[model samples]
Target: MAPLRSRRRRALAVPVGLALTASLGFLPGSATAAAPQTADAPASAAEAGPELSYVVNTETGAGTVGKVKKAIAKAGGTVVTAHDRIGVIVVHSANPDFARTMRTAEGVQSAGATRTAPLKAAGTTEVGKPEKVREPRSAAALAAARASGQEPLESLQWDIAAIRADKAAEVNPGSRKVTVAVIDTGVDDTHPDLAPNFSAKQSANCVGGLADTGKGAWRPYTEDDYHGTHVAGEIAAARNNVGVAGVAPGVKVSSIKVSEAETSLFYAEAVVCAFMFAADQGIEVTNNSYYIDPWMFNCKDDPDQGAIVEAVSRAAKFAGRKGAIHVASAGNSSFDLAAKSLTDTSSPNDTTPVERTVDPSKCLDIPTQLPGVVTVSATGPKALKSYYSNYGLNQIDVAGPGGDKYQVPEAPAKDGRILSTMPGGDYAYLQGTSMAGPHVAGVAALIKSKRPDASPQEIQWLLKAHADNPGCPTEPYDPDGDGKVNAECTGTQHINSFYGFGIVDALDAVEK
Candidate 1:
């Protein structure tokens, strides 16, 4: 799927612009002057209301957090949340001068007015097939299959019979109930195969001012992106004939639309609201397939940028704390996340070379980059890295089958081979890291269903420990270095960047 761009029109201010410049290693004092704030004079203190957050300098060390908090309190601003890593202080105040006052305060770095609102429901986008209701496959057939005790299937493509056979021995298919939230465009609650698994409550579109589809109020009425529907099917398509089965056949799915064919800003409020809804609905697992690229250079870690991350992180943490697991796509952009410099770091002697820096005007990658969220990368059925799938050893937790037909070095014969659900019909072949994310998500739901007591971290560790390492070279494509692959470029016994922990092993995860 093509990436959605940001639609925010307002230009950033001085501190923010300066921060972006500094992040790119540009001289701090060399930044261009920012445009005037607003034409109208500052609103009265009462009209301005209280400030909600204070943006801080990324250069400020950790020690500055307490000092900044003290200052906020002295200003009668109640600190609601503090993001130390990104230097942001979420507060409750309507003060219009909050940004100006905090910018001048010692250790304050920068301050800006922040807004927080309740996440609203999203409207239905595309309407596909209705949900499906099915009778349990023969218990006798399942018993006999288990009695044979044959080895589990090994093909990368999803096999329903195989999953059922393997899980039948230990899992009571009826007893394992899991709710997976598809936080993407939307789902076709009417799809025959998906109907049985969808929540009776119609899905919600969080986009504001959108038409109210029967699914939810205020959801935008738009063309079916088919993104979320495909994802939903991959996680819980019923075991009926006419299509492939999901990793977890019996799990339930809840659709939450947070994106459109338009822009990311159109869905920003929707995204935040989706997270809040997921937490309140007791939905255990959420699959986020969308993301915003990093903003301006130094602005990668700017408070505004970090605010979204922190908010998402808090929501994920809340879900985790509530026994839910959040899974997101690592992204399709291939870059060494650890090696990329978002800010200028002063070497011991301030002599280290500074190369390309990320743009801070862009919003940092979402859901995947958010803390406490399990970021997943894509791998072909052959266990090779999908050319389009992004990789960051530290960021991506695992890999799964996301058919990659559009990468460099002509896509292999199996290029367009992702096993997922398609609208208007049952399961079909599709490809992308978007396809890969749900495979892991379905497996996660299965794990949670089978081991209800396991913590989110424990489940993550279990999945990682059981992954099958796809031995891809460690030295990323060296365009200029000697063509030969070096020894250090080889795979080790454990985790590596190309394939974090390795391709997810369903059998091992379920058994472990």
Candidate 2:
């Protein structure tokens, strides 16, 4: 619908962070790349060719891992890192057949290149930048905000009130013991609002299949890398009377930078590293705003794409087993994910996109459609499904305020987009399912704080239980009022395609 409006902003500027020359070894906390076992061979791994990154998933065990690494070495590939616990190995090689060769290793379950492009592939596309938000001009609202214990910029945030986060904070600001990880482009811990609650110890740069937890490793590479910072602000910006307060302001937040510096592409290698690092660190939650790149939808039937899905799914499953709950955006294409077949024109985003028809049932969006993730859809201030949000009867778990340009707020707040912290300590407006995922992550963090001992599955159950469903719209679901229907809402009033179990409620998370 409407040319598939997936707003994953990227720049045509000089690309950085794609040079994968890091020495081989498991990072202190993170291990190999995430999952799969086969692909036909084009050439032997020993033959020199363009450098590419690959993940080799194998049977878990020291013996199995050793045999796999030996196989990787014999195939003329360098071991970027090997995760013995999960049987995933991040390998780099100029050998054209590294992935195909590894698939034959005795203990290997799956193997495939993480990208169709070379090691230093650059993005050829560009997206519009986010708009910088100014202070609300109403003096009466400013005075009221100051008097009501709201932060300086809190008056500009209608999203907090939309999900009753403002009221939830008053009852309980949430426990700092719970930490949610923003697994995206880097985060700026220096922002005044985020600095206080940011957890440096848990943060790292998981770029190019390696995790670096050194001081400031988690900071954004450039001012334009603001997605993670905006996401962090939405989840746990401090309550101190500085800027806008977060939904769970008292909880701690960490950053696991997975996107390439300028291209802002999230390759599978980086994604796997981020998930493994977060889960190993005992992180309670992770917010995944973007899909695993190269492919928008990784089909399990295709050998290479299948391995990409398996790698990501394995890491996500491991995180769940390790007590980390993942919250991901339901996507912005506005397609019915439950539909039988859909046309996809964005596969292999790293080099060039090739159009292909795919079945939603088999061609899944990684991590988002992966089992055990709290898949969130976007909603506007009016408590309606956002025009850009993807929906399916049983796919969406909950809805959150991701903002909408059409759903303008009242006097105090002017912009309909979600207001959040940018890199250089500035505030801006960005609207997408990317923004929506953090809200769900924040609410889940609140649940973790209140229940302290609950498992990931239990926390997910609580989220669906406490949500306030707005059921499918009784009238034709057209926000623009155009004669043509923008999107059709399906399912019963209680749990439908658009609102999932309904909009998330922060107040009930603590009280219930």
Candidate 3:
């Protein structure tokens, strides 16, 4: 199965060294729950099963939430925390039937296990297999690039140049008032390119469903956890003439580390916390690069999946309601997310995955597929859709320079992937819609800086309005140049499957 885009990339290389990369407690009626026993109950409440996390959705009311909490306690679950604003309570349960029992309770809109795996255990994905540089730049070429009157490595950042971000910077380098939170693995804020504009106050470690704002709380916890750092650099790596420049170098960026340390799995609870934190922190935008874990597509027909959806959806909407625009990657699977049916074999990804054919209408990729979130596709240096970017008409809101393996960029960049800040104050080249999302997030930050009073919905519309749609190709898209057509394009030039409203125009975002 295609690995999710959180770190999706084929082996690529750069001249630089291959440096690839909470908690709430609800203290409620401790001893007793008034609810009755459940049929699907485990052998004994004393002998708890594998500990699991679940989300219990309910209507917003003190009486309703109180009764639901009582029911949860009775079902052998502990309230991890509750988002009173969204009426979503996070629960940890060792009882195998806890979700089943909670669903039968009054005032519970939905309930389900948040993951297939027990707490703390998660499946791992390799960062990427490093290979020889595809287009190695000569020493003279490197020197010439460094001579450019921008960040030392700015000349290597073709992705920035592709969207005219280099030009955009001179006009309005963005605003310190605007902050885009990287809601992914974690970001290395110490990187010289990112530190100057990093906003520690807005950053946190949201793993395990709680926000930890301790010093260095929001940093990559493991060696391979470099995705968020790369993403943050793409958005606002500071124009300090050190490393590569970001799309909106003047903007402030905060890291919201949500993915688990060992497994890199992005659980629903952590995702919800990140969104809620972003909303409460007054973040102008957030970049979500992965599908919620366990299920690539959360099918509402299923009880547990439905609860995960409701809980996360509520959090995302709450962020929007509070004026935070969320920009999410369209995924790296290359599946047409708007199609009738799609295959998801790597779902329940924290455990053994079961292959299933799912309808796009029902099963949704969280955050990205949610309403009011700007869904982004990726493009190559040539402005063609990246080979691995997921796309669809109406489903995608914009496209960005995500890099393409088949469409190699020129020297200095020296690879078909993107270059951004990595952990350890270094930089590396990687690619995915994961990379694309941040570019758009940077543009959205620029928009937020320009139109500070605009709402999330308005900024989203403006993103499309300023996008430069390449128009649907008359012929089938074959970016890889194989005999077979890779993916078909749909919709009109103004709005299509391949390029969305077209590549996001950062220059116009500031100039317009």
Q: How far is candidate 2 from the true structure (C-alpha RMSD, Å)?
A: 7.3
Predict model 2's lDDT versus the native. 0.78
Residue 137 CA error for candidate 1 (Å)? 21
User: For candidate 1, lDDT tens digit of each residue in 1-512?
Assistant: 22211101100000101110103332211121322122133334545542333333323366788877766665545665554544555555444444444555577644543222112211111111222212133566455434554211112233332223236323533223678888776777667667778874535665431223354432223423556776787777765543345667677887877654343222333455566666667777888766532231124354444444544454456666777788877654444445444442211011233444554234355556666677787765446666556666566688776654432222212223444454554334445566667778887787777788778788788778877776665456532245743112223547777677878766665666
What are the per-residue Cα lDDT tens digits for candidate 2 across 237-304? 99887778899999999999887865677888898999899988999999888878767787786666
lDDT ranking of the models: 3, 2, 1
In candidate 1 the C-alpha lDDT for residue 255 amounts to 82
To one decimal, what is the Cα RMSD in angstroms of model 1 from the true structure? Answer: 11.9
Candidate 1 segments exceeding 4 Å error: 1-176, 208-224, 264-267, 293-300, 342-356, 359-364, 406-415, 426-428, 473-491
The number of clashing residue pairs in each candidate reads 38, 8, 4
**What ranking of all candidate models by TM-score puts the best one first?**
3, 2, 1
Between candidates 1 and 2, name the one with more favorable lDDT. Answer: 2
lDDT accuracy of residue 507 in candidate 2:
95
C-alpha positional error of residue 432 in candidate 1 after TM-score superposition, expressed in Å: 1.9
Give TM-scores for every candidate, taking all chains together and pairing residue i with residue i: 0.64, 0.90, 0.90
Error of 2 at 326 (Å): 0.5
- Residue range 1-512, candidate 3, lDDT tens digits: 12342323211111134332101111111112323347344326565567888899998988889989888887778899988778999999877667777777898888888887788774111123322122334576566655765676666678998999999998999999999998977888888988999999999999989999999999988646777777888899887756688999999999998888677778899999999999999999998877788777888887778888999999999988999999988877778988999887776667766778888999998878998889888888878888777888889989998877677777755566677787777677766787788899999999999999999999999999999999877777888777789898988878899888889999999999
